[model samples]
Target chain A: MRSFLSSRWGKLAIGVVLVGFAAMLPLLNIHIPGVLPGPTYTPGALSVLAYAMLIAALALSYHLIFGVAGMLSFGHAMFFAAGAYGLGILLNLLAPSGMPPEAVFLVAIVLTLVVALVLGNLVGALALRVTGISFAMVTLAFAQAANVMIRRNTGDLTGGEEGVRLEASLVPEALVGVVNTRNLYWLALGILVLVYLACVWIERSRLGHVVAAARENELRVTVLGLRPYTVRLFVFGAAAVLAAVAGIGFMLLQSSATPRISTADFTLTLLVIVVLGGVGYRWGAIVGGIVYTILDQRLAELASSSWIAELPPVLHIPLSEPLFILGMLFVLVVMFAPGGIVGISHRLTKGRGGKKDAAEPAVLQDLEA
Target chain B: MSTVLLLLITGVGLGALYFLVASGLSLIYGLMGVLNFAHGSFLTLSGFLGWEVGRRVGDGTWLGLVVGMLVGLVAGALVAAITELVFIRRLYNRHIEQVLVTVGLGLASVALFEGIWGSDPIQISVPGWLRETTEILGSHIPNDRWLLIGAAVVVLALIVLFLQRTSYGLVIRAGVENRTMVTALGIDVRRAFTIVFAIGGAAAGLGGVLASVYFGTVSAHQGTSLLIYAFIVTVIGGLGSLSGAAIASVLVAVIQQFANYYWGIGDLAIVLALAVVVLVRPTGLMGKVKH
Candidate 1:
């Protein structure tokens, strides 16, 4: 048992079990139906699932910078928004008629990747010079600049204050065949799983170790002859690509993109999700994503009910009440559950083995100390 | 040329309002390192209070302003107390937690405000004496705009006196510079924080009244939107520097007005200008660089 627990294959097996359970979640929902009966099987449910998946991807990408890389980026939404708009513009130009829509989608994804890389490089180069809060503010400046540029040049392509819409050319044929909503959901879920696995793989690799080490102590990493800036730039670019991919996925789900999508609200939402899920934990992102999605959807549903509608106009709040609730959740999490769901889970599990390891020195003691 | 003059005057007037809002934010941050994201919402709340008072007692603009300021004082103290007891007290040295908690508070305040007031913008007309436009450099500028500028100057003088001329203000400044030393000297740091917060709140309330009169309307969501501009001013002026905030507010107002005239893009141009300033000067116009 001890040997199995220590082995990498054992960990891989556990991961496989987790993924298998996730894959069968829809089946499980069917078995226990009508518990929360608002379109769990329909195309609408699939669309919501797709959105949740996209949020998961975005949250995971945020974790890469904030969790693994130890850089708090207050403006990562800019890159995501930029990628979506880039794709929107590309699909508009291509206008795939009778040709496979996947081809156009792929083209858009590639374009978004390129854009993300360039943005990541430029911003990383400038921001890496400073650390901590300044880094966050610099990134915010970039995002604000992107938002302004898009809003100002509205006549050219952004659809101005009205926002840009997705033409029919971007929707794939495969998506059309199996309920476009289902296909989108599956696509987003598949991408999310793939990205999560990629992140886990990276976390176990030599590059991940270097990055983790750099985050722990940049000066120490520098003394060890590692170029912290190069490592940061690469990780930043990779994370940007993940965020961009999520953006494309969001476009697929929403069928449109607006400058408002990159606003402070979205940024804060992502931050809350990350923090609520436990900042640096891997599985925490997925857990956080699911919780946030459920909470958001439920609150939105409640806010739009007939009873709410019947209330006097003075007392009735708008769709943003969900955001308010989410914000409150964030504050509570920061105050009481700093470790987040995953962190709390770890603590609980670790408690079981406490007596056995009580006498032993802590792992990562040098770093923690 | 007349258009330019109009834009400039309007910009200056708007800048005066920005100064009022940003000064409160600056003082709060300066004293306690608490980046009160809810500052703008406090302004909105004060406006609501003023509007309610104006509606109740007709032709009482000055009275409304006074009521707003008093309400602001109470609101600020209450919020600061709650936050200190509930959140800020725990995260005294933790900057990230401080930011997150304040942001959450800001969001909750918006929700509460919206729940009470709904989404529609509320119009608040100034009294007759303040409504008429006076000729200024061949242009008809509203007396309300002049009043805003004058009020900002007066507030600035009062704040300066309070901070520089009074013992309590000296203690507050000393706390900002060295909290540990002040605590060591047997001063109640928490009490000092409460006073600073109340003062900041009052300033925001005053700004909110000006905003209601100038815009001729108030909305529950105004705080969130206006927050972006105030944040820009705070950043460009240098975080935690009142003088820097004052200067940055004027700069932002003038630039924003010019952008509105030339660029014709409502909020985008000003946002871009602010971004440019941050890029050029990360520490702000007068912010001390941390080495």
Candidate 2:
């Protein structure tokens, strides 16, 4: 534990500081003037914060698979949704009305993780048989298929197009006074910290090195006598669990699970977050999630306003607020900052020591050279 | 049995449409190793163009097709050129970057279409001659379906002939086999890429025309919905192999039609069926890459 803290204490310290800041955000919101005069302590903002953290967690999971394992899964959302619905089903069946909302939420997270493990095994088993673009396509196919199935078949439990709503009992009474949003935000922050620590721990573990090596060259790992497939499957499962936990956080915040959870928009947004934050770099997902959520919320507000809608026909581009901005950002990032925000930060901080930043520089050099 | 036959016919028609769209995607992927995610957007845009042309040209089906194809060709060239200059030029060797930039372009195209066309789904009527249904083997099939199938066959034959008989096709094939070798031999590979990209775009545009006629509706979201299936078809048939993509298109279409017919659940079963196939055959049936 001492060695772990000393080696990467910077990341852990940052995580603590971020969580502390997040905890204070709700308190700060109360003091801010002219924000919105409803509740001095709003649950909605907390819910949004929770959802953002959940997204960050999912993005981080994708980073592990894409960055460390070198597996570009277009369908990782499959696991995420599955894990969420898995919890949704359990809560609906078991808790019904007796269990507290917080307990139900906790139970859901566990159930989701288990479901992810099973799904990870199945998908990984099949995906490991392939490499490169083929693997990506296969994963995408599975995710798309799963999305369709979930949206169609389990309508009764999932609430179909209407979405499954949480019973009032599912929310903790303790949270009722605090405003459900604040409770959720705190909960999300707690989960995010735990998950981030887990990811960091995994990154520093021996298995993590094996996974990274497998990403570098599967054949070389195979020659080294390690079962690259097993390493990939384990990491994929772990990543799925992380994503599922995030999904649970999302459900708690939204108080429901809709077919929109599986929409192309959601998948695309997640991809944007991952790319915007930088694919593999540590803390990239968290940074990306914050930027994306803030932009999205602000853009929606701007688009809905009367002044923007009243603009001249030729000069006005409708729905050009968030999506256009995001699209342009994506293009610019791919063209210039291929490493993403976190990647750029790493480079800046590394300065002369950046020679140790191995694989990414080599990949970028290949692009530039 | 009648239902089965009906499904089969309908499947073949849809498959033909998918073939028109996916052929370009497969070709582009083969030569350039870049998946043109915006292919579906091109199709949707062309469909809208066809609708506009039909409305303006007093309901002439041939004129609509001509205008749609012309617009598609121009749009295709523009998109290909822009993508080449902006994204593809930077991501020549990086597969992930290629995927990311194309996806970004796809999103931008979708947003642009939404901005122009609004968020609603627009219905595009078929021409008078193509509106009637014909009875074949005790099953009623739409005339437009038959026309689309015929068009697909013609397109397929033309593509085969062009690839087999033409010098440019030979060069493309050679380039696909080995880009470095072709470039080393002094062929302007960039020019070849531009042509390939344009051709791919044209195919997508033509597909839009067919889709508008068949679905009777066009929407900004249509491109994304169709893209997944097209990607699946290309992957299942083997990426970069025209024959494989064509065959896979038919297979996917037939399966989807049957699933929709018998299962009656929706598009999900068809997607699941495709996933099953992928799980079993990661490299697809005709993929050159060994899994």
lDDT of 2 at A322: 65
Worst 10 residues of 1 chain A by lDDT: A360-369
TM-score for the A-chain in each candidate structure: 0.85, 0.85
Query: Who wins the DockQ comparison?
Result: 2
What is each predicted model's overall lDDT from 0 to 1?
0.73, 0.74
| Tens digit per residue, CA lDDT, model 2, A1-369 | 434543657556865787788788777745433223233357655565567788888788877787677777787887677766776677777675566667766776676677788888888788667767767767777777677766665546776677676554665565434455677778788778877877888888999999887776667899999998888888888888887877776766666677777665566677888788877775777889877876777676777778878888544574555687688788788778877888787777567554246235222222211
Clashes of each: 0, 3
Tens-digit lDDT string for candidate 1 (B155-179): 8888899999998999988887778
User: What residue pairs clash in candidate 2, if any at all?
Assistant: A43-A181, A101-A170, A101-A171
Q: How do the residues B1-291 of candidate 2 rate in per-residue lDDT, one tens digit apiece?
A: 767788889899999888988888888888877777778777877777767766677554667666765665566556666667667876777766887788887887788788888879987655677777788888888888887788788878987887889878887888777777888998877777777877777777777777877877788887788888888899889888899988999998998887777767546665565566677776677876321
